[model samples]
Target: MIAIQNLTKQFGATTAVKNLSLAVNPGETFGLIGPDGAGKTTTLRVIATAMRPTTGQVTVAGIDVTHDPEAVKKTIGYMPQRFALYPDLSVLENLNFFADVFGSPRAQRTELIARLLGFARLGEFQTRLARNLSGGMQKKLALAATLMHRPRLLLLDEPTTGVDPVSRREFWDLLTQVHLDGVTIVISTPYLDEAERCQRVGLMYRGELIACDDPRQLRANLGAVVFEAHSTRALQARKLIEHRAGVRVASAHGDQLRLLLDCAERAAEIQTFFHANAISVDDWRQVQPRLEDAFVLMIAQEKQP
Candidate 1:
Protein backbone atom coordinates (compact mmCIF):
# COMPACT_ATOMS: atom_id res chain seq x y z
CA MET A 1 0.00 0.00 0.00
CA ILE A 2 3.03 2.24 0.38
CA ALA A 3 6.36 2.46 -1.43
CA ILE A 4 9.32 4.79 -0.93
CA GLN A 5 12.48 4.77 -3.03
CA ASN A 6 15.69 6.68 -2.48
CA LEU A 7 13.73 9.13 -0.35
CA THR A 8 15.60 12.11 1.11
CA LYS A 9 14.30 15.19 2.83
CA GLN A 10 16.64 18.11 3.49
CA PHE A 11 16.21 21.29 5.47
CA GLY A 12 19.04 23.76 4.90
CA ALA A 13 22.22 21.68 5.28
CA THR A 14 20.53 18.99 7.35
CA THR A 15 19.11 15.87 5.73
CA ALA A 16 16.33 14.44 7.85
CA VAL A 17 15.76 11.36 5.67
CA LYS A 18 18.53 10.01 3.46
CA ASN A 19 18.22 7.38 0.78
CA LEU A 20 15.52 5.59 2.74
CA SER A 21 13.57 2.89 0.93
CA LEU A 22 10.68 0.81 2.25
CA ALA A 23 7.49 -0.93 1.18
CA VAL A 24 4.33 -1.77 3.12
CA ASN A 25 1.98 -4.49 1.99
CA PRO A 26 -1.77 -4.09 2.00
CA GLY A 27 -3.54 -4.92 5.29
CA GLU A 28 -0.27 -4.78 7.19
CA THR A 29 0.73 -2.73 10.24
CA PHE A 30 4.26 -1.44 9.65
CA GLY A 31 6.16 0.56 12.26
CA LEU A 32 8.98 3.04 11.78
CA ILE A 33 11.03 2.74 14.98
CA GLY A 34 13.81 5.13 15.97
CA PRO A 35 14.94 7.86 18.33
CA ASP A 36 14.54 11.60 17.97
CA GLY A 37 16.00 13.20 14.79
CA ALA A 38 15.99 9.79 13.11
CA GLY A 39 13.75 11.01 10.28
CA LYS A 40 10.82 8.73 11.07
CA THR A 41 8.38 11.62 11.11
CA THR A 42 9.89 13.23 8.02
CA THR A 43 9.50 9.97 6.14
CA LEU A 44 5.86 9.61 7.26
CA ARG A 45 5.12 13.21 6.30
CA VAL A 46 6.38 12.59 2.79
CA ILE A 47 4.20 9.49 2.51
CA ALA A 48 1.20 11.39 3.83
CA THR A 49 1.88 13.99 1.16
CA ALA A 50 2.13 16.70 3.80
CA MET A 51 5.79 17.38 2.94
CA ARG A 52 7.52 17.03 -0.40
CA PRO A 53 10.60 14.81 -0.53
CA THR A 54 13.88 16.44 -1.52
CA THR A 55 14.88 13.63 -3.88
CA GLY A 56 13.05 10.42 -4.69
CA GLN A 57 9.62 8.98 -4.94
CA VAL A 58 6.73 8.05 -2.64
CA THR A 59 3.56 6.28 -3.69
CA VAL A 60 0.52 5.67 -1.53
CA ALA A 61 -2.04 3.10 -2.66
CA GLY A 62 -0.33 3.21 -6.08
CA ILE A 63 -0.65 7.01 -6.50
CA ASP A 64 2.55 9.04 -6.78
CA VAL A 65 2.71 11.45 -3.82
CA THR A 66 4.70 14.12 -5.65
CA HIS A 67 2.69 13.97 -8.83
CA ASP A 68 -0.80 13.88 -7.30
CA PRO A 69 -0.69 14.66 -3.60
CA GLU A 70 -4.40 15.44 -3.47
CA ALA A 71 -5.37 12.00 -4.69
CA VAL A 72 -2.86 10.47 -2.29
CA LYS A 73 -4.39 12.38 0.61
CA LYS A 74 -7.81 11.06 -0.30
CA THR A 75 -6.53 7.48 0.15
CA ILE A 76 -4.70 7.96 3.45
CA GLY A 77 -5.54 9.15 6.96
CA TYR A 78 -2.79 11.13 8.72
CA MET A 79 -2.72 11.68 12.48
CA PRO A 80 0.19 13.89 13.48
CA GLN A 81 2.01 13.86 16.83
CA ARG A 82 0.23 16.89 18.23
CA PHE A 83 -3.51 17.16 18.85
CA ALA A 84 -5.11 19.13 16.01
CA LEU A 85 -8.69 19.30 17.26
CA TYR A 86 -10.54 22.48 18.20
CA PRO A 87 -10.65 22.78 21.99
CA ASP A 88 -14.11 24.33 22.07
CA LEU A 89 -15.78 21.77 19.84
CA SER A 90 -17.78 18.95 21.35
CA VAL A 91 -16.76 15.43 20.38
CA LEU A 92 -19.72 14.96 18.06
CA GLU A 93 -19.30 18.43 16.62
CA ASN A 94 -15.65 17.78 15.86
CA LEU A 95 -16.52 14.54 14.07
CA ASN A 96 -19.17 16.29 12.07
CA PHE A 97 -16.78 19.05 11.11
CA PHE A 98 -14.18 16.64 9.84
CA ALA A 99 -16.84 14.66 7.99
CA ASP A 100 -17.88 17.86 6.26
CA VAL A 101 -14.28 18.69 5.45
CA PHE A 102 -13.93 15.31 3.79
CA GLY A 103 -17.20 15.84 1.95
CA SER A 104 -18.85 12.83 3.46
CA PRO A 105 -22.33 12.51 2.11
CA ARG A 106 -25.01 14.02 4.31
CA ALA A 107 -26.76 10.66 4.20
CA GLN A 108 -23.73 8.84 5.63
CA ARG A 109 -22.36 11.38 8.14
CA THR A 110 -24.64 10.41 11.04
CA GLU A 111 -24.05 6.67 10.70
CA LEU A 112 -20.31 7.13 10.15
CA ILE A 113 -19.96 9.41 13.13
CA ALA A 114 -21.94 7.03 15.31
CA ARG A 115 -19.77 4.10 14.26
CA LEU A 116 -16.55 6.03 14.82
CA LEU A 117 -17.66 7.21 18.26
CA GLY A 118 -18.36 3.63 19.30
CA PHE A 119 -15.16 2.32 17.70
CA ALA A 120 -13.10 4.86 19.61
CA ARG A 121 -15.14 4.23 22.79
CA LEU A 122 -16.07 7.88 23.02
CA GLY A 123 -19.84 7.49 22.72
CA GLU A 124 -20.51 8.51 26.31
CA PHE A 125 -18.45 11.66 25.85
CA GLN A 126 -19.93 12.78 22.54
CA THR A 127 -21.51 15.77 24.24
CA ARG A 128 -18.34 16.66 26.09
CA LEU A 129 -16.07 19.35 24.67
CA ALA A 130 -12.74 18.20 23.29
CA ARG A 131 -10.87 20.22 25.95
CA ASN A 132 -12.59 18.19 28.64
CA LEU A 133 -11.29 14.81 27.43
CA SER A 134 -8.16 13.11 28.70
CA GLY A 135 -4.99 12.97 26.64
CA GLY A 136 -5.87 9.51 25.38
CA MET A 137 -9.44 10.47 24.54
CA GLN A 138 -8.18 13.49 22.67
CA LYS A 139 -5.94 11.25 20.60
CA LYS A 140 -8.87 8.96 19.86
CA LEU A 141 -10.92 11.92 18.77
CA ALA A 142 -8.14 13.03 16.46
CA LEU A 143 -7.97 9.54 15.02
CA ALA A 144 -11.72 9.47 14.52
CA ALA A 145 -11.54 12.78 12.72
CA THR A 146 -8.77 11.50 10.52
CA LEU A 147 -10.78 8.40 9.65
CA MET A 148 -13.93 10.32 8.78
CA HIS A 149 -13.38 9.76 5.10
CA ARG A 150 -12.59 6.06 5.57
CA PRO A 151 -9.13 6.26 4.08
CA ARG A 152 -7.61 2.93 3.12
CA LEU A 153 -4.25 3.70 4.76
CA LEU A 154 -3.38 5.36 8.07
CA LEU A 155 -0.22 7.44 8.54
CA LEU A 156 0.17 7.83 12.29
CA ASP A 157 3.20 9.54 13.83
CA GLU A 158 3.61 8.52 17.48
CA PRO A 159 -0.11 8.27 18.20
CA THR A 160 0.43 7.18 21.81
CA THR A 161 3.54 9.08 22.85
CA GLY A 162 2.28 10.79 26.04
CA VAL A 163 -0.69 8.57 26.78
CA ASP A 164 -0.80 6.58 30.01
CA PRO A 165 -0.11 2.86 29.97
CA VAL A 166 -3.77 1.81 30.11
CA SER A 167 -4.73 4.26 27.40
CA ARG A 168 -1.84 3.18 25.27
CA ARG A 169 -3.07 -0.38 25.46
CA GLU A 170 -6.57 0.72 24.60
CA PHE A 171 -5.30 2.71 21.62
CA TRP A 172 -3.40 -0.28 20.29
CA ASP A 173 -6.43 -2.47 20.72
CA LEU A 174 -8.31 -0.06 18.53
CA LEU A 175 -5.51 -0.06 15.99
CA THR A 176 -5.44 -3.85 15.93
CA GLN A 177 -9.13 -3.86 15.19
CA VAL A 178 -8.61 -1.39 12.37
CA HIS A 179 -5.80 -3.47 10.96
CA LEU A 180 -7.88 -6.60 11.16
CA ASP A 181 -10.54 -4.78 9.21
CA GLY A 182 -7.99 -4.30 6.41
CA VAL A 183 -6.80 -0.69 6.74
CA THR A 184 -3.08 -0.65 5.98
CA ILE A 185 -1.27 1.37 8.67
CA VAL A 186 2.20 2.88 8.74
CA ILE A 187 2.98 4.28 12.17
CA SER A 188 6.16 5.75 13.70
CA THR A 189 6.84 5.19 17.36
CA PRO A 190 9.62 5.51 19.96
CA TYR A 191 8.27 2.64 22.06
CA LEU A 192 10.00 -0.65 21.36
CA ASP A 193 7.15 -2.53 22.94
CA GLU A 194 4.78 -0.88 20.51
CA ALA A 195 7.07 -1.80 17.63
CA GLU A 196 6.91 -5.41 18.71
CA ARG A 197 3.19 -5.34 18.07
CA CYS A 198 3.73 -4.46 14.42
CA GLN A 199 3.76 -7.18 11.74
CA ARG A 200 7.04 -5.70 10.51
CA VAL A 201 9.28 -2.84 11.61
CA GLY A 202 11.86 -0.61 9.93
CA LEU A 203 14.60 0.64 12.24
CA MET A 204 15.86 4.08 11.29
CA TYR A 205 19.16 5.64 12.36
CA ARG A 206 20.89 8.87 11.38
CA GLY A 207 18.23 9.39 8.70
CA GLU A 208 18.81 5.96 7.16
CA LEU A 209 16.75 2.81 7.41
CA ILE A 210 19.25 0.40 8.90
CA ALA A 211 17.22 -2.74 9.51
CA CYS A 212 13.79 -3.94 8.42
CA ASP A 213 12.16 -7.17 9.57
CA ASP A 214 9.74 -8.79 11.95
CA PRO A 215 10.50 -8.12 15.63
CA ARG A 216 11.44 -11.72 16.34
CA GLN A 217 13.71 -11.90 13.31
CA LEU A 218 15.49 -8.71 14.28
CA ARG A 219 16.05 -10.02 17.81
CA ALA A 220 17.37 -13.34 16.54
CA ASN A 221 19.80 -11.59 14.17
CA LEU A 222 21.30 -9.49 17.00
CA GLY A 223 24.34 -11.84 17.11
CA ALA A 224 24.58 -11.66 20.92
CA VAL A 225 23.17 -13.06 24.11
CA VAL A 226 21.14 -11.00 26.61
CA PHE A 227 21.37 -11.48 30.36
CA GLU A 228 19.16 -9.78 32.90
CA ALA A 229 20.95 -8.77 36.07
CA HIS A 230 19.21 -7.86 39.27
CA SER A 231 20.84 -5.98 42.12
CA THR A 232 19.84 -3.57 44.81
CA ARG A 233 22.64 -1.30 43.58
CA ALA A 234 21.58 -1.41 39.94
CA LEU A 235 23.50 1.73 38.96
CA GLN A 236 26.70 0.38 40.44
CA ALA A 237 26.20 -2.95 38.71
CA ARG A 238 25.73 -1.19 35.34
CA LYS A 239 28.94 0.81 35.85
CA LEU A 240 30.92 -2.35 36.62
CA ILE A 241 29.52 -4.37 33.74
CA GLU A 242 29.83 -1.70 31.01
CA HIS A 243 33.65 -1.79 30.85
CA ARG A 244 34.05 -5.54 31.14
CA ALA A 245 35.65 -7.56 28.31
CA GLY A 246 33.20 -9.24 25.87
CA VAL A 247 30.36 -6.96 27.05
CA ARG A 248 29.09 -5.14 24.01
CA VAL A 249 26.41 -3.07 25.75
CA ALA A 250 25.06 -2.60 29.26
CA SER A 251 22.02 -0.49 29.95
CA ALA A 252 19.76 0.08 32.93
CA HIS A 253 16.28 -1.17 32.30
CA GLY A 254 13.96 -0.10 35.08
CA ASP A 255 15.42 -1.53 38.32
CA GLN A 256 17.38 -4.22 36.45
CA LEU A 257 20.44 -4.05 34.23
CA ARG A 258 20.26 -5.59 30.76
CA LEU A 259 23.63 -6.84 29.58
CA LEU A 260 24.41 -7.62 25.95
CA LEU A 261 27.39 -9.93 25.80
CA ASP A 262 29.50 -10.80 22.77
CA CYS A 263 29.01 -14.49 23.44
CA ALA A 264 27.13 -16.83 25.74
CA GLU A 265 30.37 -17.76 27.54
CA ARG A 266 30.68 -14.12 28.65
CA ALA A 267 27.77 -14.59 31.05
CA ALA A 268 29.98 -16.33 33.62
CA GLU A 269 32.64 -13.63 33.26
CA ILE A 270 30.00 -10.94 33.78
CA GLN A 271 28.79 -12.68 36.92
CA THR A 272 32.36 -13.02 38.22
CA PHE A 273 33.06 -9.36 37.41
CA PHE A 274 30.08 -8.24 39.47
CA HIS A 275 31.20 -10.53 42.30
CA ALA A 276 34.68 -9.04 42.16
CA ASN A 277 33.34 -5.49 42.13
CA ALA A 278 31.29 -6.06 45.28
CA ILE A 279 28.12 -5.22 43.31
CA SER A 280 25.54 -7.61 44.67
CA VAL A 281 24.13 -9.87 41.98
CA ASP A 282 20.72 -10.82 43.31
CA ASP A 283 20.00 -12.80 40.11
CA TRP A 284 21.33 -13.33 36.59
CA ARG A 285 20.06 -15.39 33.67
CA GLN A 286 20.27 -15.56 29.90
CA VAL A 287 17.08 -14.33 28.28
CA GLN A 288 15.72 -13.94 24.80
CA PRO A 289 16.79 -10.69 23.19
CA ARG A 290 14.18 -7.98 22.93
CA LEU A 291 13.54 -5.47 20.15
CA GLU A 292 15.21 -2.78 22.25
CA ASP A 293 18.35 -4.89 22.51
CA ALA A 294 18.41 -5.46 18.78
CA PHE A 295 17.88 -1.74 18.15
CA VAL A 296 20.66 -0.71 20.49
CA LEU A 297 23.00 -3.22 18.93
CA MET A 298 22.12 -1.94 15.46
CA ILE A 299 22.84 1.63 16.52
CA ALA A 300 26.12 0.66 18.20
CA GLN A 301 27.30 -1.20 15.10
CA GLU A 302 26.31 1.74 12.87
CA LYS A 303 28.46 4.08 14.96
CA GLN A 304 31.47 1.77 14.67
CA PRO A 305 31.69 2.34 10.91
Candidate 2:
Protein backbone atom coordinates (compact mmCIF):
# COMPACT_ATOMS: atom_id res chain seq x y z
CA MET A 1 0.00 0.00 0.00
CA ILE A 2 3.10 2.19 0.31
CA ALA A 3 6.08 2.48 -2.03
CA ILE A 4 9.32 4.48 -1.93
CA GLN A 5 12.04 4.43 -4.53
CA ASN A 6 15.52 5.91 -4.28
CA LEU A 7 14.24 8.28 -1.58
CA THR A 8 16.71 10.73 -0.09
CA LYS A 9 16.26 13.44 2.54
CA GLN A 10 18.88 15.89 3.71
CA PHE A 11 19.26 18.66 6.25
CA GLY A 12 21.83 21.21 4.98
CA ALA A 13 25.18 19.43 4.98
CA THR A 14 23.84 16.25 6.60
CA THR A 15 21.72 13.58 4.93
CA ALA A 16 19.18 11.90 7.21
CA VAL A 17 18.09 9.36 4.63
CA LYS A 18 20.13 8.40 1.57
CA ASN A 19 19.14 6.45 -1.52
CA LEU A 20 16.56 4.39 0.36
CA SER A 21 13.75 2.28 -1.05
CA LEU A 22 10.97 0.24 0.58
CA ALA A 23 7.43 -1.07 0.17
CA VAL A 24 4.62 -2.08 2.51
CA ASN A 25 1.94 -4.40 1.25
CA PRO A 26 -1.73 -3.99 2.11
CA GLY A 27 -2.65 -5.50 5.51
CA GLU A 28 0.99 -6.15 6.35
CA THR A 29 2.84 -5.09 9.51
CA PHE A 30 6.24 -3.73 8.50
CA GLY A 31 8.69 -2.71 11.19
CA LEU A 32 11.56 -0.25 10.78
CA ILE A 33 14.35 -1.17 13.20
CA GLY A 34 17.39 0.94 13.99
CA PRO A 35 19.29 2.97 16.54
CA ASP A 36 19.06 6.71 16.96
CA GLY A 37 20.10 8.75 13.88
CA ALA A 38 19.42 5.72 11.67
CA GLY A 39 16.96 7.79 9.58
CA LYS A 40 13.91 5.63 10.36
CA THR A 41 11.98 8.70 11.50
CA THR A 42 13.00 10.67 8.43
CA THR A 43 11.81 7.91 6.13
CA LEU A 44 8.49 7.72 7.95
CA ARG A 45 8.11 11.48 7.71
CA VAL A 46 8.61 11.38 3.97
CA ILE A 47 5.97 8.65 3.61
CA ALA A 48 3.62 10.58 5.89
CA THR A 49 4.24 13.61 3.69
CA ALA A 50 5.18 15.59 6.77
CA MET A 51 8.27 16.72 4.86
CA ARG A 52 9.28 16.77 1.24
CA PRO A 53 12.04 14.40 0.18
CA THR A 54 15.21 15.88 -1.23
CA THR A 55 14.84 13.58 -4.23
CA GLY A 56 13.20 10.35 -5.44
CA GLN A 57 9.59 9.15 -5.37
CA VAL A 58 7.16 8.17 -2.59
CA THR A 59 3.59 7.06 -3.05
CA VAL A 60 0.76 5.84 -0.86
CA ALA A 61 -1.71 3.52 -2.53
CA GLY A 62 -0.44 4.72 -5.93
CA ILE A 63 -0.77 8.48 -5.26
CA ASP A 64 2.64 10.20 -5.40
CA VAL A 65 3.42 11.82 -2.04
CA THR A 66 4.99 14.90 -3.66
CA HIS A 67 2.45 15.23 -6.42
CA ASP A 68 -0.57 15.03 -4.08
CA PRO A 69 0.26 14.79 -0.39
CA GLU A 70 -3.21 15.81 0.69
CA ALA A 71 -4.80 12.88 -1.12
CA VAL A 72 -2.18 10.54 0.36
CA LYS A 73 -2.82 11.94 3.81
CA LYS A 74 -6.45 11.05 3.45
CA THR A 75 -5.61 7.34 3.25
CA ILE A 76 -3.03 7.07 6.04
CA GLY A 77 -2.79 7.76 9.79
CA TYR A 78 0.58 8.93 11.12
CA MET A 79 1.42 8.79 14.84
CA PRO A 80 4.72 10.55 15.27
CA GLN A 81 7.22 9.77 18.04
CA ARG A 82 5.82 12.66 19.98
CA PHE A 83 2.17 13.03 19.01
CA ALA A 84 0.60 16.38 19.77
CA LEU A 85 -2.45 16.17 21.96
CA TYR A 86 -4.14 19.03 23.76
CA PRO A 87 -3.11 18.23 27.33
CA ASP A 88 -5.78 20.47 28.79
CA LEU A 89 -8.44 18.78 26.71
CA SER A 90 -10.26 15.80 28.09
CA VAL A 91 -10.03 12.50 26.26
CA LEU A 92 -13.38 13.02 24.57
CA GLU A 93 -12.54 16.60 23.73
CA ASN A 94 -9.25 15.63 22.11
CA LEU A 95 -10.99 12.99 20.04
CA ASN A 96 -13.64 15.45 18.99
CA PHE A 97 -11.05 18.02 17.96
CA PHE A 98 -9.14 15.56 15.80
CA ALA A 99 -12.38 14.36 14.24
CA ASP A 100 -13.16 17.92 13.29
CA VAL A 101 -9.63 18.47 12.00
CA PHE A 102 -9.94 15.38 9.83
CA GLY A 103 -13.31 16.64 8.59
CA SER A 104 -15.28 13.68 9.90
CA PRO A 105 -18.95 14.09 9.09
CA ARG A 106 -21.04 15.54 11.92
CA ALA A 107 -23.51 12.75 11.41
CA GLN A 108 -20.93 10.01 12.00
CA ARG A 109 -18.73 11.64 14.62
CA THR A 110 -20.75 10.54 17.62
CA GLU A 111 -20.86 6.86 16.69
CA LEU A 112 -17.22 6.94 15.62
CA ILE A 113 -16.13 8.58 18.86
CA ALA A 114 -18.15 6.11 20.93
CA ARG A 115 -16.63 3.13 19.10
CA LEU A 116 -13.12 4.50 19.44
CA LEU A 117 -13.51 5.19 23.13
CA GLY A 118 -14.36 1.54 23.58
CA PHE A 119 -11.66 0.38 21.20
CA ALA A 120 -9.01 2.36 23.04
CA ARG A 121 -10.49 1.30 26.40
CA LEU A 122 -11.00 4.90 27.43
CA GLY A 123 -14.77 4.75 27.75
CA GLU A 124 -14.80 5.32 31.53
CA PHE A 125 -12.00 7.88 31.43
CA GLN A 126 -13.29 9.84 28.46
CA THR A 127 -13.97 12.85 30.66
CA ARG A 128 -10.47 12.86 32.19
CA LEU A 129 -8.04 15.49 30.92
CA ALA A 130 -5.23 14.11 28.79
CA ARG A 131 -2.60 15.47 31.21
CA ASN A 132 -4.21 13.56 34.06
CA LEU A 133 -4.18 10.21 32.31
CA SER A 134 -1.46 7.66 32.86
CA GLY A 135 1.34 7.40 30.30
CA GLY A 136 -0.22 4.33 28.71
CA MET A 137 -3.67 5.90 28.60
CA GLN A 138 -2.24 9.01 26.98
CA LYS A 139 -0.65 6.86 24.29
CA LYS A 140 -3.92 5.06 23.64
CA LEU A 141 -5.73 8.36 23.43
CA ALA A 142 -3.16 9.61 20.94
CA LEU A 143 -3.70 6.48 18.87
CA ALA A 144 -7.47 6.97 19.05
CA ALA A 145 -7.06 10.49 17.79
CA THR A 146 -4.90 9.28 14.93
CA LEU A 147 -7.67 6.85 13.98
CA MET A 148 -10.36 9.53 13.85
CA HIS A 149 -10.42 9.52 10.03
CA ARG A 150 -10.14 5.72 9.73
CA PRO A 151 -7.12 5.83 7.45
CA ARG A 152 -6.27 2.67 5.50
CA LEU A 153 -2.64 2.60 6.63
CA LEU A 154 -1.12 3.38 10.05
CA LEU A 155 2.36 4.86 10.42
CA LEU A 156 3.52 4.57 14.04
CA ASP A 157 6.90 5.90 15.19
CA GLU A 158 7.94 4.00 18.32
CA PRO A 159 4.44 4.07 19.75
CA THR A 160 5.43 1.97 22.75
CA THR A 161 8.61 3.74 23.69
CA GLY A 162 8.84 4.92 27.33
CA VAL A 163 5.77 2.90 28.24
CA ASP A 164 5.98 0.34 31.04
CA PRO A 165 6.17 -3.33 30.11
CA VAL A 166 2.52 -4.03 30.86
CA SER A 167 1.44 -0.96 28.93
CA ARG A 168 3.65 -1.90 26.02
CA ARG A 169 2.04 -5.32 25.83
CA GLU A 170 -1.40 -3.74 26.01
CA PHE A 171 -0.53 -1.35 23.20
CA TRP A 172 0.61 -4.19 20.96
CA ASP A 173 -2.67 -5.96 21.63
CA LEU A 174 -4.48 -2.87 20.38
CA LEU A 175 -2.25 -2.84 17.29
CA THR A 176 -3.13 -6.47 16.66
CA GLN A 177 -6.80 -5.53 16.74
CA VAL A 178 -6.14 -2.75 14.25
CA HIS A 179 -4.30 -5.16 11.97
CA LEU A 180 -7.17 -7.61 12.18
CA ASP A 181 -9.42 -4.81 10.99
CA GLY A 182 -7.40 -4.91 7.73
CA VAL A 183 -5.39 -1.75 8.20
CA THR A 184 -1.84 -1.93 6.90
CA ILE A 185 0.75 -0.84 9.50
CA VAL A 186 4.26 0.56 9.16
CA ILE A 187 5.80 0.92 12.60
CA SER A 188 9.29 2.06 13.64
CA THR A 189 10.74 0.66 16.86
CA PRO A 190 14.13 0.25 18.55
CA TYR A 191 13.05 -2.93 20.31
CA LEU A 192 14.04 -6.05 18.39
CA ASP A 193 11.30 -8.12 20.04
CA GLU A 194 8.75 -5.68 18.68
CA ALA A 195 10.32 -5.97 15.25
CA GLU A 196 10.01 -9.76 15.49
CA ARG A 197 6.24 -9.36 15.59
CA CYS A 198 6.12 -7.72 12.18
CA GLN A 199 5.51 -9.61 8.96
CA ARG A 200 8.76 -8.12 7.71
CA VAL A 201 11.46 -5.95 9.27
CA GLY A 202 13.83 -3.40 7.72
CA LEU A 203 17.11 -2.66 9.48
CA MET A 204 18.27 0.92 8.98
CA TYR A 205 21.79 2.19 9.64
CA ARG A 206 23.78 5.16 8.39
CA GLY A 207 20.66 6.41 6.53
CA GLU A 208 20.24 3.24 4.50
CA LEU A 209 18.26 -0.01 4.74
CA ILE A 210 20.94 -2.62 5.36
CA ALA A 211 18.64 -5.60 5.76
CA CYS A 212 14.97 -6.47 5.29
CA ASP A 213 13.19 -9.78 5.80
CA ASP A 214 11.00 -11.83 8.09
CA PRO A 215 12.42 -12.29 11.57
CA ARG A 216 13.08 -15.99 11.07
CA GLN A 217 14.85 -15.52 7.78
CA LEU A 218 16.94 -12.68 9.09
CA ARG A 219 18.09 -14.70 12.11
CA ALA A 220 18.93 -17.66 9.90
CA ASN A 221 20.88 -15.47 7.52
CA LEU A 222 23.25 -14.41 10.27
CA GLY A 223 25.20 -17.63 9.53
CA ALA A 224 26.60 -17.74 13.02
CA VAL A 225 26.28 -19.99 16.05
CA VAL A 226 25.47 -18.44 19.41
CA PHE A 227 26.78 -19.73 22.75
CA GLU A 228 26.17 -18.55 26.28
CA ALA A 229 28.83 -18.74 29.00
CA HIS A 230 27.91 -18.34 32.64
CA SER A 231 30.81 -17.10 34.71
CA THR A 232 31.58 -15.07 37.78
CA ARG A 233 33.30 -12.55 35.53
CA ALA A 234 30.98 -12.25 32.57
CA LEU A 235 32.43 -8.92 31.51
CA GLN A 236 35.98 -10.29 31.54
CA ALA A 237 34.90 -13.33 29.58
CA ARG A 238 33.23 -11.07 26.98
CA LYS A 239 36.38 -8.94 26.75
CA LEU A 240 38.50 -11.99 26.07
CA ILE A 241 36.48 -13.22 23.06
CA GLU A 242 34.95 -9.93 21.80
CA HIS A 243 37.93 -9.22 19.56
CA ARG A 244 39.02 -12.81 19.03
CA ALA A 245 38.98 -14.29 15.54
CA GLY A 246 35.93 -16.49 14.72
CA VAL A 247 33.91 -14.68 17.40
CA ARG A 248 31.40 -12.64 15.41
CA VAL A 249 29.95 -10.77 18.41
CA ALA A 250 30.27 -11.00 22.18
CA SER A 251 28.05 -9.30 24.70
CA ALA A 252 27.07 -9.59 28.32
CA HIS A 253 23.52 -10.71 28.90
CA GLY A 254 22.84 -10.52 32.61
CA ASP A 255 25.34 -12.87 34.32
CA GLN A 256 26.09 -14.70 31.09
CA LEU A 257 28.38 -13.79 28.25
CA ARG A 258 26.58 -14.32 24.95
CA LEU A 259 28.92 -15.03 22.08
CA LEU A 260 28.22 -15.47 18.39
CA LEU A 261 30.87 -17.62 16.80
CA ASP A 262 31.71 -18.23 13.18
CA CYS A 263 31.21 -21.98 13.65
CA ALA A 264 30.19 -24.53 16.28
CA GLU A 265 33.83 -25.61 16.44
CA ARG A 266 34.62 -22.16 17.82
CA ALA A 267 32.59 -23.03 20.92
CA ALA A 268 35.27 -25.48 22.12
CA GLU A 269 37.98 -22.94 21.35
CA ILE A 270 36.10 -20.22 23.30
CA GLN A 271 35.80 -22.55 26.27
CA THR A 272 39.53 -23.27 26.15
CA PHE A 273 40.27 -19.56 25.92
CA PHE A 274 38.15 -18.88 29.00
CA HIS A 275 39.87 -21.78 30.81
CA ALA A 276 43.35 -20.50 29.99
CA ASN A 277 42.40 -17.00 31.19
CA ALA A 278 41.21 -18.51 34.50
CA ILE A 279 37.81 -16.86 33.96
CA SER A 280 36.24 -20.07 35.30
CA VAL A 281 33.10 -20.56 33.25
CA ASP A 282 30.51 -22.39 35.39
CA ASP A 283 28.29 -23.39 32.47
CA TRP A 284 28.29 -23.35 28.71
CA ARG A 285 25.53 -24.05 26.18
CA GLN A 286 24.42 -23.21 22.68
CA VAL A 287 21.63 -20.69 22.35
CA GLN A 288 19.27 -19.85 19.52
CA PRO A 289 20.16 -16.88 17.35
CA ARG A 290 18.02 -13.82 17.99
CA LEU A 291 17.03 -10.94 15.76
CA GLU A 292 19.09 -8.64 17.96
CA ASP A 293 22.15 -10.79 17.33
CA ALA A 294 21.59 -10.54 13.59
CA PHE A 295 21.06 -6.80 13.84
CA VAL A 296 24.28 -6.26 15.78
CA LEU A 297 26.22 -8.46 13.40
CA MET A 298 24.86 -6.67 10.33
CA ILE A 299 25.56 -3.20 11.74
CA ALA A 300 29.05 -4.27 12.78
CA GLN A 301 29.73 -5.62 9.28
CA GLU A 302 28.51 -2.35 7.76
CA LYS A 303 30.97 -0.40 9.90
CA GLN A 304 33.92 -2.37 8.55
CA PRO A 305 36.25 -0.69 6.04
Please write out the lDDT profile of model 1 over residues 1-305, one tens digit for every residue: 99899999999999999998889999999999988999998998899888999999989888999999999999999998985898999999999889888999999788999999999999999999999999999999998899889889999999999899999999999998889889999999988999999999999998999999999999988999999878778877888667777888888866788889999898887777778877788678889998999999889889875
Q: What lDDT does the true structure give each of the candidates?
A: 0.91, 0.93
State the lDDT of candidate 2 residue by residue for 1-305, as single tens digits: 98899999999998999999888899999999988999999999999999999999999999999999999999999999999999999999999999989999999999999999999999999999999999999999999999999999999999989888898888899999999999999999988889999999999998999999999999988889988878878887888778899988889977888888899998998788778878888678998999999999999899989
Give residue 133's lDDT in candidate 2 (0 to 100): 93
Count of residue pairs whose backbone atoms collide, per candidate: 0, 0
lDDT of predicted model 2: 0.93
Those runs of model 2 whose alpha carbons end farther than 4 Å from true positions after fitting are none
